[model samples]
Target: MRKYALLISLLIIISAINLNAQDDNEKQLLKQFHSITSEEMSGWLEKLCSPEFNGRLSGTPEFVASAEWVASKLKEWNIKPAGDNNSYFQWFKWPYTIINETGSLTLNLRLSDGSVIRKNYQYPNDFYPGMNSGSGEITAEVVFVGFGVTAPELNYDDYKGIDVKGKIVLMNRDVPHTDPRNPEYKKWVAYCYHQYKLENAVRHGAAGMLYVDGASANPNITYDPSIIVCGIGPQPLEDIFAGIKTTNKALIEKIRASFKPASFNTGKVMTIKANTTRVNEGRACNVIGYIEGTDPVLKNEVILIGGHLDAVGNAGRVVNGALDNGSGVVDIMGAAKALAQSEIKTKRSIAFIFIGGEEVGLIGSKVYTANPSFPVGKSVVFINLDMVGNGTGFYVSAGSSYKEYLKYFEQANAKYIHRPMRTAAPEAGEYYGRPRSDEVVFRTAGFRTMAMWTTEATKKVYYHLPGDDTDAVTIDIMEDVAKMIYLALTEMANDPEIKF
Candidate 1:
C-alpha cells in the first residue's frame, strides 16, 4: 500500500509540472501570450548591459560570464545542444584589445651629417596616430605616396616604383575633391582607395602612413558626419572617409617636403616602453542552441535564427546598450523559454545562434556559415533580429527565394501582433549589401535568410550609443515582437508543407 501511494504521488507531481508548463504557453490577449514581456527583456538588458556586467567586453571575464549565463538559461528552457561536440558555443578567436595610450609622438630628424633634430607633438592635441597597426620605432626618409593607391583599373599605382618598404608613406585622403560622382577624383573608384592603401601598404611592406591635412581639394570640407564613428577598429573611420572625395589633395601633396622627416617613436611599440597587443590570433563564434523537431521526415532539417551578438564596446559602458542589442539578446532568451513550453511539436529543428565579433566586421557569422554546427545546405531559413524598435511596426527583409515565406510571416504578425510589422521582397541595399548584421553571413552561403530590424535611421537616438539602456525599452513592445516571432516560428516549424 505504501509503495503504491509513493508511485501515485510521483505521477501526480510530474503531471502537475507538465500542466503548469502548458499553462505558461497558452495563447491569450496582448498581455497573455508574451509572458516574456518587453519588461522582462528590458530588465534582463539592464542587468546584462549594466556596469556590473563590465560592459560585456567580448573575450573578457565579463564576456565569458555573460555567455555562461545565456547557456545556462537555454538549458533551463530545456533546449538541447545539437552539435556533435555537444557544446552550444563554437568559439573562435580574433585579434583585439582595449585602447591604452600614453602620449604624443616625437620625430627625430637626422641630417646627412648625422646631427639630429627633435620634433614632437602633444598627442591628438597636435596629431593622431592613424589607425595603422604599430611597428617598432624607425628613423627613415618619408616619401609622398599619392592617394596611397595601387588600383590597376584606372592605371593608378601610387606605390609604383616607390620603395615605401621601410619608410613612411605620406598620402592624401580619398580624393582632392568637390564631387561625389567626380570622374577625375575617381568617385567610381574612390571607395577602393582606402582598401587599396591598406593592401598596398601591407604588400609593399610600408612601415606606416601619415595623412597630412589639406589633402582635400575642397578647403572647407570638414569631416563627413554621415560616416559611422564606432570604436571597433578601422571600418568606422574608413567608412567616414570613404565618402570623402577630395580634401585639398593639392595642399597635402605640397606639404610633403615640409613633413620635417622626424623619427616617429609614437604609439605602443618596442621602444615606447608600453605593452602592445593585437588580435594576433582570434576566430569567430556562433553562439548556438536549439529546440528539436518532432516530425520524422523533417527532423533532420533545421531552422536557424541568429544575431550578431557583438558590439564596439567603446560607446560609454553606459551605452550599456539597453536597446542596441541587450533587447535582442533578451528577446532570443525569452523566446527560447516560451517555445520550449509550446505544445506544438516542430517538424524541423530550430536553432538560436548568437554570434560574436560582429562590430569588428562580420567575423563571427562568416565563420559560422563556413563551419556550422548543423548542415548549412539543409537549413530552411535563417531569421535574424537586429536593433528592433519599441512598439512601432517593424520590417523584414528576406532572401530572394523566401518571398512566399516572408508573406506568411507578415500575415502572422498582422493577425496576432498589435504592432505593425511589414515585409518586403528581398533585394539589395537596405536588405542586402549593407553590413548591418550577421544575416549576411548565412545569406552569402546560399541559405534562405531574413533580417528583421527596427529599420536603421528609424531607431531611437540611443540605438548605438551608451545611453541605449533598459530604461528606454518598453516591455509592451517586446511582448508584441515576441508574439510575432513565436507565431512565425511555430507556423514554420510545424508546417511540413513549407517549401522554398
Candidate 2:
C-alpha cells in the first residue's frame, strides 16, 4: 500500500512538471506571434495602396509618399535606422523614363502589283515602340532574321546570305543563335538567332529592329514602361521589349483586312521615325524595419525576411504584385510583427526588408548589398517570401540551397497546424518556371537564401496585372505562414549552435 502511494505521488509530480513546460512553450509562442497583428497588417496594406502613395512607382510622387509611410512604420517600431540619411529611407539613383505622347509612322506598302498602301510600318496596332526605345520611325527593307541570335560559337548564322546592314532586322524569340546541327549544339535555335541580330544589324548600319511573335497572344499582356528599372548607360528594358510581340491572330487579321504583309515596303526604301522616353534621373527606395532581440551577445546578427516592394507598371499602374510580392510582404510583415510582440526574448536580430525594383531584376536588393549598413556577408539566412498569399493552391516550395531550412519550417508547421506543405526538388521545380525576384541577387552575393512562392493564386489569376490587388489576399493563410516563420525564428534564435 505504501509503495502504491509513493508511485501516485511521483505521477503527480511528473504531471506538474509536464504542465509547467507546456505552459512555458505556450507563453513563448504567444510572445512571438503577437507583435504584428492581422489588424496591423491590414492597415499597412491599406496605407501602401492609399491614393496618397499613388501606387508607389519609383521616382514618382506616389513613390515618395509610400516611402514616407514605410519609414513612419519603422520609426513607430523604434527600430534603429540603417540608412545614413538618419531616417529609414534608402534611396538609389536611376536614370531615364519613357516620355510618352501619341505619334505614329505611316506604312506605305509597295505590292507586287506595283503600288503600296503604306510607306513605313506605322503606330498603334502595327507595332508599339519598345520600352524606352528611342522615339523615331524607320523606313527600310524588313529582313526576317529568325530569332537573330548571334552565337558564332554555335556556327549558326541566320543573316548568312543577307547583308542587313542599314536595314531593319526582324527576328523571332528564344531561338538558338547558333546552328543546332553541331555536335555541341542542341536547343535554342530561335533564341540564339536574336542574340546579336539587332546589334549586328545595327553594327552593319542597320537602322533598327522588329522582332515579331515571342509566343502566343494575350491582350492582357503588360508592356514595360519604366526605363529606370532597365539600367543606366545604354541598354534598356524598353529596347528589349520594343520589338517583342506575340504574332497573335489579330495581327494577321489586321494585315489581311486593311494592309498587306507584303506591303512592308519589303525591298523599297522609306523613312522611319522612332521615339522613346527614359527615366533619365530618378530615385528608388527600399523599405526596412527590425524587431530587436533580448540577447545582448546575439542581438546584432539577423535573420532577414522580405520580398520585393516594387512591381512593373502595367495599365497605368506598376505590377499589381499581389501574389508576386504583396502576399510575401504580408507574410513577412505578419511574422515580424508576431515576433516583435512575442515573449521569446533571445539573441540575434530580426530584420524585415521590403526591397524596391525587384521586377526589373532585384535592383533594390542589389543596391542594398552594395552599401549595406549591416555586414551583409553575415546575413547567414534570408527567407524571401515572394508569391505565397493565395487560397492555398500548389505550395510549389523550391530552393535546394536551403533544404534544411525548409525542413525546419515544415516541422514547425506540423507541430503548430497544417500537414506537410507541398514541395518539389529544385530541378523538377525548374520545369514549372524559373522567374527572378530580389532573392536571386542575395544568393548571387554568396548569401544562403531561399524564396517562397506559389502558382496557386497565379493559376486563378492575379499574378501581375491590375487584378493583383490586396483584395485577393487570404489573411488566414497569411497568419498561418506567419506562425510557421515565427516558430522557426524562435527555434533558430534560441539555439546557441545554429549560427555558423
Can you tell me which runs of candidate 1 are displaced by over 4 Å? 1-32, 52-58, 101-148, 158-199, 202-276, 279-284, 315-322, 428-436, 456-476
Model 2: lowest-lDDT 10 consecutive positions: 226-235
- lDDT string for model 1 (191-216, tens) is 33444555565666765445543111
lDDT of 2 by residue, 1-500 (tens): 99999999999999999999989978777666655456666666666655565444555555656666666756765665666566676788754344354234343446679877653332333444443344555666655554454555655555665676667655444443233345443443323332234445455555655546321111111223311111111121123223445332343344335422311223434344545455657677787777666787677777777776655443233335555566677677677666766666657787878787665545678887787756776565776777676765335343564565566566676776573367653522121122245666676666667666544442455544455567767656666777777787877776676623
Error of 2 at 198 (Å): 6.2
Q: What TM-score goes with each of the models?
A: 0.67, 0.72
Q: Which candidate is the best by lDDT?
A: 1
lDDT of 2 at 321: 57
List CA RMSD, all candidates: 11.5, 8.0
Report how far residue 1 has shifted in candidate 1, in Å: 55
Per TM-score, the best of the predicted structures is 2
**Cα TM-score of candidate 1:** 0.67
